[model samples]
Target chain A: DAGITQSPRHKVTETGTPVTLRCHQTENHRYMYWYRQDPGHGLRLIHYSYGVKDTDKGEVSDGYSVSRSKTEDFLLTLESATSSQTSVYFCAISEKDPQETQYFGPGTRLLVL
Target chain B: SQQGEEDPQALSIQEGENATMNCSYKTSINNLQWYRQNSGRGLVHLILIRSNEREKHSGRLRVTLDTSKKSSSLLITASRAADTASYFCATVVSNFGNEKLTFGTGTRLTIIP
Candidate 1:
């Protein structure tokens, strides 16, 4: 384990409802990221934070928003859940290094019903 | 998307057989990484190969990067049934603490015992 934990490991929600996934890391890494994994799309980045209060959008940031209030917690929120938004959400952290090798959490599986 | 494309979307082999998965990307990258994901879990980083390096080995895993061809290959020797999982190749482009990784659809490897 990379000292990372995701809340609500499995979730089922209806359409148009809001959902939030939380990622917490104790490694005190400077980089944290959120990604969604689907059948054919592989893992697409949604958002990332370089440090507390510093964040950026990733390639597939649509329908997703993220916030990092502190160094250890990164939150991903879906304003309104949709069937298309159902995916396995992963949180990864990497130390400040050249390679940027990410260590991932156990993941949270979201199902939009 | 400039994401890596993995060949042989699915592979099946008996235990003890070697497996090779190839990935080809469309653009220049600073580094390439391999990840493995088991059912109902998050992805685990396997290895990383820099653009400047040609080959690297980690135990039974071997990774080769050929920047000239924009390609990389992962070789697993003496595979076991426990090794069955999905393998992905992610390419990292750009730096400056805002790194983005493009991932391939992935190869589903089934090691039959």
Candidate 2:
């Protein structure tokens, strides 16, 4: 609905392998976020970007990293993926305004074997 | 740690019934928002109630916020089969620049025909 799309809708990889998920938005929103959803864990923030080249860590940023070199694309990479990182990842974008509602992408499901 | 906790981890209701879910948070919030996820898909923004607002409504959805109790509730009137999904509540804390949202574990709703 927000012109947001996440690449690699589903993936299964062996442990210790590196994986990168991409989120692209046509809306050119100023804020972008990456979150992971797991059983009994709800949705936890991994990383977020306020603008291009400006990013910050979140609650679960241990094994994940994010980059936003441009306004339209935000990338999440799991360096040496682990089994604990197996979950559904969602990307969201919102305006700079604090009261603006966030729009989410379709999500990517990753399984680490 | 999770910022918000939703009550009634799972709910079952008939198609014409009303479904209600409650969320409680620990810290002060600037606003509270609701989101819905359809199975394996991404989450969709449903409604948002600002700290200054007491109640808000959209279509068949009604949201009420009580900052004094640090809690919020979502009510879906005349819920349909399509409304069956996982509902989550997110809170925006009173921080400066980035308004990072923390989401609840979610309440799974099953609509019986």
Using Cα atoms, each model's DockQ against the true complex is 0.68, 0.71
Docking quality (DockQ) of candidate 1 = 0.68
CAPRI-style class, candidate 2: medium
Candidate 1 residue runs with Cα over 4 Å from true position: A97-99, B95-97
Which pairs clash in the backbone of model 1?
none
Regions of candidate 2 where Cα sits further than 4 Å from its true position:
none
Which window of 10 residues has the lowest lDDT sum in candidate 2 chain A? A93-102
Question: What's the true lDDT of residue B87 in model 2?
Answer: 97
lDDT of each: 0.91, 0.92
Local accuracy of candidate 1 as per-residue lDDT tens digits, B1-113: 54799988999999999999999998888999999999887889999898899999999999999999999999999999999999999998776755687889999999999
Model 1 Cα shift for residue B102 (angstroms) = 1.1
Return the TM-score for candidate 1, rounded to 2 decimals: 0.96
Steric clashes per prediction: 0, 0
| lDDT per residue (tens digit) for residues A17-101 in model 1 | 9999999999999999999988889988899888899988988899999999999999999999999998999999989952568
Residue pairs that clash (backbone atoms under 3 angstroms), model 2: none
